[model samples]
Target: MMFKKIGLFVVIVIVVLIGVMTFNTFTNTADDPIFEVVEMPAIDTNAVAARLSEAVRIKTISTDVGDPPASAEFDQLHLLITSAFPLVHENLKRDVVGDHSLLYSWEGSDTSLPPALLMGHMDVVPVEPGTEGDWEEDAFSGAIKDGKIWGRGTLDDKLSVFAILEAAELQLAAGFKPKRTLYFAFGHDEEIGGENGAGKIADLLEERGVKLAFTLDEGMVIVQGMMPGVEEPIAFIALAEKGYLTLKLTATTEGGHSSIPPKTTAIGKIARAITRLEENRFPAALNSPASDMFDTLAPHMGLPLKAIISNRWLLDPLLVSELGKGGATNAMVRTTTAITITESGTKDNVLPSTATATVNFRLLPDTSIDDVVDHVTKVVDDPDIKISVKQGNEPSRISSKSGEGYQLIEKTIRETLPDVLVSPGLMLAGSDSKHYETIAENSYRFLPMRFGPDDLSRVHGTNERIYIDSYVEIIQFYRRLLENTGG
Candidate 1:
């Protein structure tokens, strides 16, 4: 009788556990609002593509060192802007900030409401030396073939710069002005550190006592075959971007012959330090941006994934561990360490007195530079190794998805691309949006264009291009966004 009663209780417990999991999975659906589809007005897409191609042809390249490049290229592009978009140049008050950076203000009817700002960079990284031959079209040709505009800046940025101007020009033609103010910021040196361009612009705006409702800069995009379990294209609207920190590590010891080394050579010591850092990674968790993303997309996923995601209380450890497996997804969870540059002995046969390595870290939103320094110190516990930060910036603040400006952008995406699911995400890399934290109430990072898996390498790689239709879609998305702000 005791055995039978115990078996009955076990069976009941199993059934209840299953019942709870099933209920949670079913209820964990996306809270997507139904949006009415918008009809796009006929646009001269050919003209738009031609304009973008012209912009790309100008070699407005920026480098890691000295740039807001003192060249005639930026001047030529500025001339094109003034000539091509007559209405925009005539009406929107334009200011030349930080040498080559451009800022345009379109005064709205109402002065009480804070403004919305859109940003893009005009600078493009130079084509690598030997790889120039690998391109299907000339690197600066701006060739339009197979329904694509091929060039360096076409994807990395020129699209946003042209798209915003095109949308504003179109709206101005229709005699429509925003009720809330709008600003267009075009940074000239974002390819580098952006210290001279967007950074200065932010300072200037702050000095003027201008606070924004929101600011949008290009970062994430609509992607396919990237997120796990979801097959369709989903848009990642990055709520925050990862912080950047680069540390230079050095080791010093008594010089000696390679055969007659001390207890450990400098090279070996630094190498061991780097290996320790790689092996012992930062703790992983399904934090916001990632956590927010999963919650939004959970309902769209398969049953197993949905169950795992919804029942995080029971399965967070397993789920978080699995998330750290993929290269791209792994960056979404914890601070990532990468050994970029290393230098050792001049003559391989000689034991070097000093060895050095440069390591880069992309910190998660919650992680600080000092926190990273402490982690490295603890992990690489050798007193012989010295660590110093070369350059660093803390992560951007997480913007609200429920904010009015975010919803305005979200609704625009829904209306323009009705089929794509939009979700909050974390940007793995940096952007000019980092500088606008103080001047803007919230900052968003997204470009409404479809990107596939392989398109990742094409940005600064060979065959950099943007689809003509995609370019048109970007223009329409911005137009819809600007129209939505006409309260």
Candidate 2:
């Protein structure tokens, strides 16, 4: 009887071991599909470098609408586009909307499908007058050196415009035709808020009863050391962007001499209000596109981190707390507030009659401007301080993750960059796509390039540059994207 009991226990232990082995094998096999690389045509590095240089030389800097320079530069850039991409000009139907918006439609073989929009901006921000001396080469020179292309728009967005055209020109030369119609919308005033450019273009297309399958713009890029627990570089595709809100906090009291002042002056009240705002920030939640980013990257991460990310429901609060320790990661999970401008007393000796502070808020998705105003009002609590929303907008609608738009993007990135992991994220900054939210169902913001942290800082900063290899990769990415729209 003792021998038989021992034998039964041994059999049960062996059975349990087999079950564990099978489960591990299945899970490991599941991860294999995630790592498979896609095939794409070879990229032309020299052509990409030459084209980027040509684009930067045009000085398509955006000027204030009232200035004569604005319209002149817009027209020159438009002419340059036509002259450079002859195949696109000859094949696609081009239309000029508003003052400087350019729209090109490439008719697909199958007219039944909705068109895909490849959106970019041609105009760049103006450089500061005194900062020109800080550049390694002339900001407008478009110098190619040290294996990188240096210029103003190389990172902010001329890369997108140039890459899209280069890819289309190359594909047209190779006799490749897409099944779904492609529309290239280039806005002229994206830096100054895209009102006459992308806004008008989206309106024009909507009037024609056209609904886009998807619209891609410039926002996020590939980054290393971006997220914790991820060793490999991550390519963040922005599926949503936060809203911009500006608030004016004002405190009013009777003016008096500084020698005999009230216990709480206007400046004191305003300062206290700002302190409350900074102390009390919006609660972070794991929702929207940023959560999707972690979900997609989980399997690719190491064991302990992967397990935590894969089971986010059990560890979300803890994960958010951990991410909050870093500045970049904290921005991913919460609405952020910064006091940009403050005005108070006119004179040092006299007590000011009024004090005003301007605070900028980048609101998370699902957070309304009204909600933010209420939160700020509650936090300040003092009756002397008044909080009002000066300028505000609700966050843009989130794009679908499972739709044809996302899949095509993933496929394109996979083909062009087999090594990098693609994931969806929320953009912290505003883009021209915000203007199309009412009409378009899906709008995505991504630029195809892999760069480290320093490379990212160059954008909208001094010494903006792009690797020649990265430019070539972007060209291949667009080519694959146009070719695979039907498949």
Candidate 3:
């Protein structure tokens, strides 16, 4: 009887604890910024659409084939932009910084205020050689039909380039002047490496001692279906970006006929190392940006998801496992491993003397290059496989979400996209903004348009295009963003 009474007491305690947790989870609310709603001003939709379509038609492709002059196509695109936005060329001081990168400066009424920099790459990745046939329309055709503009760079970045120019031209035509200086840095070779393009422009700005208030670049878009249980489109503004590192693992062994193979060949060794790295990935942790993202989103989530995120201290393991299932969510909390390229085998019957594999890692902030190298070496544990650091850079510093720059961005989103949820996140892909860590106090990555899962797949894949209505929304977003930032 005494044991039964103890069991009842235990059950009561458990129920009470659960009740308290539930109450706290339901009541917890993150402080959202309050801003006056600003309506998007009227503009010529046809003109904007025509210019973007024409811009997309220019085949300004960045490739690994050679250096600038990358192609006559790049030069043609530059000339076209100058012709397209004559007001921008007339008002803003245009300088050809790198081989083909264009930097336009709109001097402010108050020079004391640090300038604001807006960046976009004019280059697009080459469609896979044979996959051109897979496009709904020709990748370079810039075809506009069925309420969509079909092309390669239509969404990735050219949209920003055209929209930014359109906003600036409209503002310029209105005789609007700014309190803070504005710089538009359009890089021509972002797809290849951005070294000659954005890199050189950043160097020049740094040399001029031009400290910027903030730099905005292409990154996470305002998209729906990214979060579970939230029907509203979430605008993920990247507060921090993951570092990039490419490591080459090479295995060398005696070459001979495949019939007399040793215990392991060079190809076998490299393949095994890759498998080990894939199996034993870097440790996963709910890092700061992702944590902040959840904090901002939990209040908007529904029952079980809301409870899980709210009580993360008690439910972390299960939450992490759930988050790890999806590629997008998994990248937020952990350093990712991808074996991008493999090379080996001279012939079917002959064993190659050397094999090499390239492993790309997008490291979370606070996860250093040394930590990654150490983890990889320990995991592989192969003396024959030589590890070489091909290229690497540490992650950017996390920008504060409480600052004016972030708040202005948020305000703009609220005013333009009234129903969206704005959340801070980590950028998985590299962008030109990475070159400006030292040039600006806070750098942000956001593309102002909503994309679904299907649209997300089209970024670097087949059938790449952007909806006509969405393109107009993007232009309006930039216009509001500029007004909020003193345009």
Candidate 4:
């Protein structure tokens, strides 16, 4: 009887082990490619380089529209666009909104369906004074060297502006018309707030009773070594972008000498508030977009890490914790806060009567600005500290994961870059797409530039450049996207 009981237990254990192994094997098998062959059009690299350089030469810096309507740079940019892409100017109906926003409408063959809006900003942030010498070539010179295009807006956005127009021009040359209308929106004030550019453009479209199918804007880029557990490069599409909110944490007290100060001075109070907000951050949750990013990339990932990420139910906490370790990965999972600017203390010896610290908060989706402000107040727990939030825009709504819009984008990406895996992730930075979020059901941010690790740093940094090969590839990617639009 004892021997028989032992045999039954052994059988049960062996059966359970087999079942576990079988389930693991089935779940971990790599899936087949999402899309079949997508025809890629021939792109002219030299032409693209020439056009990009021309764009860089005309400085479209967005300045405060004072009485005279900012600088002549905006007008020069407009003229440059018309000269660069004659086909676009001839075919598309262009509308200038507010001060410098350019909205071009290419009426599709079928006007019944809503149009697809390809959005980008033409303005580049001001190059810091006296830093132009740091560049190998002039920042505004639009120099091309070593098979790369060097300039200010090359990566920050002028790439998208030119790339999309190049695609449109190619399509026009091929006599390919989109089934649905295509709208190209170029905002001039995205670097500052888009109040005058994209914001007004969205209002105009809304007034016309025109709704967008999807709007693509400039945001996250494809960078190698961006994430752990993934071997190959991952293309992170910005399905939703975090909102921008500025909170002013101010503390006022009686001014006194620095030598004879209160237990906590005005600066000390503001500093403490910032420190608390940083230490006690918003809780990290693996929301839909982030989860989808992991799920899509998991199969492509290498090794035991793949197995772990693929099976989120088994170890979700571990994955989130690991992601929280790094800045880039942590930005993917949670809202981030940084003390960007502080205005406190006038004289070195005097404890000023008031100290103000500007806290810039990148809010997560579904999280309100009010909630963030309230959280900050609660965390600081100081009745003396006054917290006021200004110029807050809620995070853009998350677009559809399984829809024609996403399918089209995914298919185009798969066709253009077969090696890189396509995944959806939240953009930590805000973009012009936020303006169209209310009008468009789906908005995605993707630029088909295959950038290695170091290449990404050039964005908004010294020695900004884009490889000639990457530039050509982006043109091809846009071409494929345009060709596939009607189909």
Candidate 5:
């Protein structure tokens, strides 16, 4: 009789919990009314595709150190850009900063209002030596076949450069003038780090005391199958980017022949230190931008995901741990850990006196460079292993999504891309926009390209290409952004 009574009480508690969860899932989520689906105007698909193909064929590759006195190919590409967009050069004031970097000023009627900067990089990463044969078409051939434009820069960013020029040229041809000034800043070496490219441009703008309304650069994209439940594509606009830190860990100890080496040899010690770091990973926390992202996505999610996301505060630990399992989403929430390069023994049989490894980290929004170094040092906890930061920077400030600048971008996106959910999220990758953070009121990192799982692998990977339809959408998005922002 007592056992029956306990079972019945357990059933009642389970029923009450289910009722509460169901209510929270349905009631806690509120739809965002600010965003509405927009229909973009028709474009000249053939002409735009042809131009993109030609742009890809130029081979304006940016190396690690950057070709300061740019190679002949870069010069040729510059000449092509000048001739290709005749209206841009004729009307807009043009200047080349940092030798190869291109900057154009479209003067507005009102100089008092801050200007908007549209940014893109003209350079592309070089194709791997052996992987060139892996491409469906010649990597540099810029082949237009099977309804796609194939080449190196088609997705990793020449599309943006071309789209900006095309949009400006068309608007100029249509006799449209902006109320606020529009600046087009194109860096020459974004792939290798943009130190001599966009960095120099930012310095020049700061010296001129030019305050920008906002800056948009390449980062995230419109992706399908990004979110689990949302069938429509999600347009992810990056509100902040992770900080970059490269720490060089060196371990020096007694060295001898490998056959009779010490138990704690230089290489062995360094390896053990790296292992400890991997085991004691940086803790994952839900940041403001990530929280906002989930909030925006909650309404579109299925019942299970919706319930969990809607009541994040109560289930914060569960959500963070579950999402922190790994991959793209994992990096968004926590400081990423990776060992990029390592060096140790001089020969197969001889142990080296010194060993080193490069530990790369992309810090979360809340984490700083110092925080990363400190955490790594604590985890390794070895006096012999010396930690030195090669290069590091704190994460960018989280741009306000509720501000006028973000709304302008959101409204433009809504009117241009129909049935897509726009969410403000963190950009895991580095971009040229990092340099413009101080100059602009808000710096957004996004590229208007539709990238799927398969298509995303093509960026700096084999068979890099862009679909004709996606290319047309990019052109439409830029035109809408310009028209809505200032024209």
Candidate 6:
């Protein structure tokens, strides 16, 4: 009789668990929207591509932080903007913030409505020294070939600046004046820290007491074949950004010859510290933006994965394990550590007296710089090693997935792409959007550009390019966005 009771109890427990999982899985899809691709009027794709190509050719490369930018190149870019976008130049109020960053304010019919801001950077990172040969075209040539525009800034960002101005220019030609004020910001040093450019712009806006209703910049993209289980393209709009931290570690030890070396030299100590950092990594957690992402994608995913994600309350560990497998996906789940640079002995035979290493950490949203310092100190367990923060910031405050800024952007993306799925994600890298988040009610980071799996390495790597048709879509997306907000 006891065995019979036990069997019945087990069966009841299984039934209850299955019932809960099924409920969660079915309800996960309540918010998914289906839309038919709507037809739109055509633009001159060739002319737009030519303008983007011309913008890409000018090298407005951002030097290291605190260093002066390329003045001549930026001057050439400004001239191109003035000449290419006569409507925008004539109608908008332009301010050259911090010399290179440009801010344009377009007055609206109703000044009482809070203003909307659109931003993109004009600067591109320099091509790696030895990898220039690996590029299919000259890194700065902006060659239009094989149905694509080839160059550095073509993908990294000059496309955004051109797209915004082009969209506004077209809208103005159509005699469309916005109901809400609009601001266009083009920062020149976003590739570096953005301190002198976007940072100053944010400060200026704050000084003027200009409270922005919303701000949009680049962080996520419309990606294909990157996420598993979903066969269609995803418009991954990142609502939060991982914080960045650079820690410099230095160690000093007794000077000695190689033959009379102590048990552990300075270099050895630093190496052990790094090994400790790597081996004992930050604990993985299925945190927000990530959790929110899976929840949004769950409805669109395949069978077992969908079931698992929706029931994260019961299967959190399993979901974390699966998502933590890939390098890109792993970044979404936990803080990442990379030992970028190290220095030790001056000569081969001598024991080094001093050793230094540079460590870069991308902090998860819940982790702070102080928390990292404390963790590293405890894990390394070394008194002789001195750790100093080179530069860092806590993760961005999570933006609202349901905010007006996000809703408008999502609507614009859905209308623009029609077939793509939209989901909130965690941005793995930093962008100029961080600086502007302070003054805006909500700041969103999504570039309307579509990227495939193979395109990931090309951004700051070789053969960075954007398709001509893709550039056309970007212009369309921005135009729709402008129209949605106030055009």
Residues 214-254 of candidate 4 have per-residue lDDT tens digits of: 88788766767766767677777878888889988889888
Return whichever of 2 and 5 wins on lDDT: 5
State residue 173's C-alpha deviation in candidate 4, in Å: 1.5
Candidate 3 has an lDDT of 0.87
Q: Rank the candidates by lDDT, best first.
A: 1, 6, 3, 5, 2, 4
Q: Relative to the true structure, how large is the alpha-carbon lDDT of every model? A: 0.91, 0.83, 0.87, 0.82, 0.86, 0.89
> Which residue segments of model 4 deviate by more than 4 Å?
1-22, 63-71, 257-261, 346-351
Model 1, range 311-421, lDDT digits (tens) per residue?
Answer: 988889998999998698789988999999999898967889999999999999999999999999999998988999999999988999899888998899999999899
TM-score of 6: 0.96
User: What TM-score does candidate 1 reach?
Assistant: 0.97
Candidate 6 per-residue C-alpha lDDT over 1-487 given as tens digits, one digit per residue, 9 for 90 to 100: 9999999999999999999999988888747655445445688888888988898889898768877899999999999999999999999999999898999998889889899999999999999899989999999998999999999898889999999999999888888889999999999899998888899999998998998988999889999887888988999888889999999999989987998889999999999999999898888889888888888888889899999988988999998888777688889998988999999898878999989999999999889999999988998899999999999988898889889888888888888898788999899999988898889988888997889888879998899999988888988888888888985
What is the per-residue lDDT of model 5 for residues 1-487, given as tens digits with 9 covering 90 to 100?
9999999999999898878878778886556556554565567888888888888998888766724544687788888888888999999998888888989999999888899999999999889889978888988888899899999899989999999998888888888899999999999889888888899999999998999989999998998986777788988889999999999999999877889978778988999998998898998988878888888888888867788887775778888888899898799778989999999876888878999999999998889999998999899999999999998878888898886678887787777876677889889888998888888899888887888879878999999999998888788888878888776
lDDT agreement of model 5 with the native: 0.86
RMSD of 6: 1.6
Tell me, by TM-score, which candidate is best.
1
Candidate number with greatest lDDT? 1
The estimated TM-scores of all candidates read: 0.97, 0.91, 0.94, 0.91, 0.94, 0.96
**What is the lDDT for 339 in model 1?**
94
Q: What residue runs in model 6 are displaced by over 4 Å at the alpha carbon?
A: 33-38
Worst 10 residues of 6 by lDDT: 32-41
